[model samples]
Target chain A: EADIYQTPRYLVIGTGKKITLECSQTMGHDKMYWYQQDPGMELHLIHYSYGVNSTEKGDLSSESTVSRIRTEHFPLTLESARPSHTSQYLCASSASTGGTEAFFGQGTRLTVV
Target chain B: QQPVQSPQAVILREGEDAVINCSSSKALYSVHWYRQKHGEAPVFLMILLKGGEQKGHDKISASFNEKKQQSSLYLTASQLSYSGTYFCGTASYGNNRLAFGKGNQVVVIP
Candidate 1:
C-alpha cells in the first residue's frame, strides 16, 4: 500500500489567518499533487510538482502556493484564509507525472470562518 | 479540460453490476479511476492507457477508447464495500496535468 499522509485532518480558522497543510509520502514517488474538493463536487487540482525543487500551478487558479524542497514532502499554504478557501485539501503521489496511478493521502479538511 | 461523468448517482444491491462513463473533449492518452468514501481521500483504482487497453483490479475493470476520448469503469459483483464516489481522471496527449470528471456517487446496499 502507498504510504502517503496528510496532517491536521481538520482545521477551522478565522478569516485572514495564514494556514498550511502538510503532506508527506514514504514511497519516494517522483510526482506529487494537491487538489481542493468541495462536498459532492469533483476535485480541482490547485498545484502539482514533478519532483523535488519543482512545483507548478494547476488549472483551478488557487490562491494557495506550494513548495517542494524535498521529494517526500509537499505542502500547500494559503497566505490569507477566506471562506472560499474552506475545502478538503488532498495530496497524492504517483510514479510519474503523466500516466501512472496516483496514491492519495487521507486529506485535510479546512474550514475558514 | 475536465471530463464529463454520466449518471451522477447510482444505487445498487450486492452482486449487481454498474458502469461509470468518463468522456473528454480533448484527445486523451490516459484515463484514471478513483474511489473515495465519505470523509476520506480518493484511492486510485486503476489506470488505462491509449490504444484501447483494458485493465482490471480484482472484480473492478476499466476500458479506454482512445479514438473516442472516453473511458468506462465496470464494477462487477458490486459489494457494499464498493459504496463510495467514483471519479474519472484524464490526461490528454502531450500533457502531464490530470483533470477529473464531476464524479458518480455509488451506493451498494446489502
Candidate 2:
C-alpha cells in the first residue's frame, strides 16, 4: 500500500463554506499531485507540487489553491465551496526520477450541498 | 495535451482477453497505466518508458511505441478482480507533468 493519506475520507458541507483538504505522504517523494474525479469519470489534474515551496496549477483550471510547506504535506484549500465542487479528490506522489510510477492515496469524497 | 483512449468501456469474461489503446499527439517519454475500482483511488499498474517497451506482470501487460506515440494495454485471461476503470497517463520529454486519457472501464465477470 502507498504511504500516502488524505483526511476526511468523506465530507459534506454547504455551499460557500471554506474548506481545506489535507494530503500527506511518508515516502519522502519530491512530486505530489491533486486530481479531481467524479464517479466513474475521468480524472482532472488540479494542482501539483514538485517539492516544498514549489507548486503549480495543473491543466484543469480549478478554484482550489494548494501550498507545499513541507515535503510530506500538501494541502488544498477552496475559498468558497460550491455545488459543482462535489467530487472525489485524490492525492498522489512519485519519485523525482523521470518515468516513475505514482502512488495514490485513498481519496476524499466531498459533497457540496 | 490529453491522450485519447479507445473503447470507452469493455466487458470480458473470466479467462477472456481484451485490449485498450491510448494515443497521444505529443511525443511521449513515458506512459503510465493505472486501475481504479469503484469508489477507490487509482492503483498504479505499470509504466512503459520510451523506445518501444513492453512489460507484464501476471496476466496484465502493456506496450508502448515511441514512434507512433501510442500505448496498448493487454488483459489476458481476465479475473473478477480486474474489474475497474483503467487510465493511461502520458508524459512528454522534459515535462514532468502527466496528461491523462479519459479512462477505459473494464468489467470482468465469471
Candidate 3:
C-alpha cells in the first residue's frame, strides 16, 4: 500500500471559512503534488513541490496555498472558501526519478456551501 | 501542457479488448498511466520511458511511441474490475512533472 495519506476524507464548510487540508507521506519522496477535480471531471494540477521550501504553481490557477516545511508533510490551505472551491483535492508523492510512478493519497473531498 | 486523449468513453463486454490513446504535441520523456474508480484516488498502472518500450501488468498493457509523442493503453479480456477512468500523464524532456490528459472512461460489463 502507498504510504501517502490525506486527512479529512470529507469536509462540508460554510462559505468564507478558512480550511486546511493535510497531506503526509512516509515514503521519503522528494516530489509532492496537489490536484483538484470535480465529480467525473479531469484532474487539474494546482500546486506542487520539488522538495522542502521549493513550491511551484501548476498550470491551473487555484485560490488555495500550500506549504512544504517538512519532507513528509505538505498542507494546502484555503483562506476564504467559496462555493466555487468545492472539489476533491488529491495529494500525491513520487520519487525523484523522472519516470517513476506517483503514489496518491485517498484524497480530501471538500464542499463549500 | 495537458495531453489529448481519444475516445472519451468506451463500453465493452467481458473478455473483449479495447485501446485508449493519448497524444501530446510536445516531445515526451515519459508516459504514465493511471486508473481511478468512482470516489477513489487514481492508482498507478504503469510507466513507459522514452525508449518506446512496452510494459504490461496482468492483462493490461501499454506502449509508448517517443517518436510520435503518443502512448496507447491496451486492455485485453476486460474484466468488471477494469471499469474506471483511465488517465495518461506525459512528461517532457528536462521536466519531471507530468501533465495529464482529460481522461478516458472505460466500462466493462459481465
Candidate 4:
C-alpha cells in the first residue's frame, strides 16, 4: 500500500484564487515531478525536484512554484489561479539510482472559472 | 522537444495485436513506457536502457535502438485491460527531465 498520493482529487475555484496541490510519496523516492495535461493531450512538465531543498522549472514554463522541504513531499502552489490553469495535474516520484521508471499519483483535476 | 509517436490512435479487438513507436530527434539514454486509463494515473510499464535491449512483461514487450533514437512497444494478444493511452518517455545522458511522446491511444474491444 506504500505509494505516492495527491490531495484534493478535484477542485473548483474562481480566478485570482490561490491554490496548492499536495503530493507525497512513502516510497522514499528522491526525485519528484509535476506535470499538466489536458484530455487526450501530451503531458507537459511544470516542475521537478531532485531532493530536499532542490526544485527546478521543467520544459514547459509554468506560473506555479514548488517546494521540496522533505524528500517525501513536493507541493505545487499557484499564487493566482486562472482559467488557463484548469487542467489535470499529475505528481510523480522516482528513485535516485535509476531514474528510468516513475511512479505517478492519481492526479488532481483543477477547474478555475 | 517532445518525442513523436506514430499512429496517434488505434483500435483493436480482443486477442489482436498492435505496435506503438516513439522516435526522438536527439540521442536517447533510456526509454520509459507507461499506460494511463481514463481519469487515472499513468502506470509504469517498463524501461529500456541505451544498450539496445528488449524487455517484456506478460506479452508486452519493448525495444530500444540507441542509434536510431527510436523505441517500439509491442502488445501481443491484446486484452481489454490494455486499453489506455500509452506514452513513451525518453531521457538523454545525465539529463533529469524526461521528454515524453504524444501518447498513443489504444482501445481494445470485444
What's the TM-score of each model vs. the native?
0.94, 0.97, 0.98, 0.95
Instruction: Judging by DockQ against the true structure, name the best candidate.
Output: 1
Which portions of model 2 miss their true places by more than 4 Å? none
Work out candidate 2's RMSD over C-alphas: 1.1
What is the C-alpha DockQ of each candidate? 0.76, 0.70, 0.72, 0.61
Clashing pairs in 4: none
The DockQ score of candidate 2 comes to: 0.70
lDDT of each: 0.90, 0.91, 0.93, 0.89
Candidate 3 chain B minimal-lDDT segment of 10 residues: B90-99
Model 3 pairs in collision: none
Docking verdict class for candidate 3? medium
lDDT of 3 by residue, B10-30 (tens): 999999999999999998888
CA displacement after TM-score superposition, residue B89 of candidate 1 (Å)? 1.2
For residues B45-78, could you state the per-residue lDDT of candidate 4 as single tens digits? 9999856899998999999988898999999999
| Candidate 4 local Cα displacement, residue B92, angstroms | 1.0
Q: On residues A1-113, what C-alpha lDDT tens digit does candidate 3 reach at each position?
A: 89999999999999999999999999999999999999998989899998999998988999999999999999999999999999999999998635699999999999999
lDDT of 4 by residue, A36-63 (tens): 9998888898888888998889989999
- Chain A of candidate 2 gets a TM-score of 0.97
What ranges in model 3 sit over 4 Å off? none
Better of 1 and 4 by lDDT: 1
The candidates, ranked best first by DockQ, are 1, 3, 2, 4
Docking quality tier of model 2 = medium
Candidate 2 vs 3: which has more DockQ: 3
